[model samples]
Target: MSAWIRMIADEDADDTLQEVLNLARTPHGTVDNVMRVHSLRPSTMKGHVILYRAALHDDANTIPMWLQETISAYVSILNDCDYSLANHWKNAAHLIGDEDRAARIGRALHDRDPAAVFEGAELALMRYAEKLTVNPGQMEESDVTALREAGLDDGQILEANQIVGYFNYVNRLLNGLGVSTAGDVVGYYAKAEG
Candidate 1:
């Protein structure tokens, strides 16, 4: 819940906000608390969803979905946003399908040691994400050069950058608004339907 305004869920959303609520629904059917916070401005919420889908879900993206989730979780960790961290960690764990591997990734991100969990292109990407999150101004052409050397073309590198930037923006938004992670997003939808 945010300290600024009351959380607006489906039940409480008015006509104008309902569209945003619908667009914000997760696969399980409930709207995310992050989206509820954005419900303060329906149009912004709509545009946010569109941008999110395009940045993270566009079919043409060469970056693997699991890698995108990993980038998001890593950025969330750097931003110290437990809300986004928990949600993205769940997505990453599910996509990765190995608890042990996921735990290693978590530990690596928490310890700020990407080498412990990744290598080759993955390691390069993680390092780039850390740099982008911690020192965006210091980012140089050399960083992009390294990713290219790791086999990512310009488009993939751009998508990776966008994903990192998106999560940073979202983590700050949720953290600034005092948003809490709603446990089991799917469970929220189930409970609401029941």
Candidate 2:
């Protein structure tokens, strides 16, 4: 929980808030502090879950779950958001299931050297994520061009863009609210949800 604001615990939640909380709850029956912080407004909590599902969990999304998590981890890294970086990196690592590859991914993100771990479209999208997180204002059409040249279609590029944007938004939200990852089970997600 954030030290700056009050969060409604699961036991204290009203029916409506409880319902929204369920959408974001882990399989282990705990809600991350990031989602719990929205307890005051159940709608926003629902909105967060919906947006998260669409951005990172929707079946319609073409980006693989592991790569999506990678993009999220990378964005979190650039934002210096420990909560998201730790959680998302764990997600990426869990999905990858290769400790050495996951370590390489982590190191490359930390070093801001996507080329070290990714090639072709993956590399291009990672570079785009880094740029968007660090210098969004400096982005130009040429960045899109580079992604296309690297073999990413417009749809995949948009998927990457949405992921990057979503993480940036949530990173600021978590940081702004002083949310902590103390009780969260990193990398956990409901099998049926995102």
Task: Give per-residue CA lDDT, model 1, range 1-194, as digits (tens).
Answer: 44356776677879989977888888777677777788778898888888888888899998988888889889999999888787777778788879999889889889999899799899999999999999999999999999999988999999999999889889888888888755336322134444
Displacement of residue 159 (Cα, Å) in model 1 is 1.0
**lDDT for each candidate structure:** 0.83, 0.87
In the predicted model 1, the residue pairs found to clash are none
RMSD of each: 2.5, 2.9
| Regions of model 2 farther than 4 Å from truth | 189-194
Candidate 2: TM-score? 0.92
Task: Determine the backbone clash count of candidate 1.
Answer: 0
TM-score of each: 0.91, 0.92
lDDT of 2 by residue, 33-92 (tens): 878988998888888888887888778788788999999999998999999988888889
Q: How many residue pairs of model 2 clash at the backbone?
A: 0
The TM-score of predicted model 1 comes to: 0.91
Q: Candidate 1's error at 50, in angstroms? A: 0.9
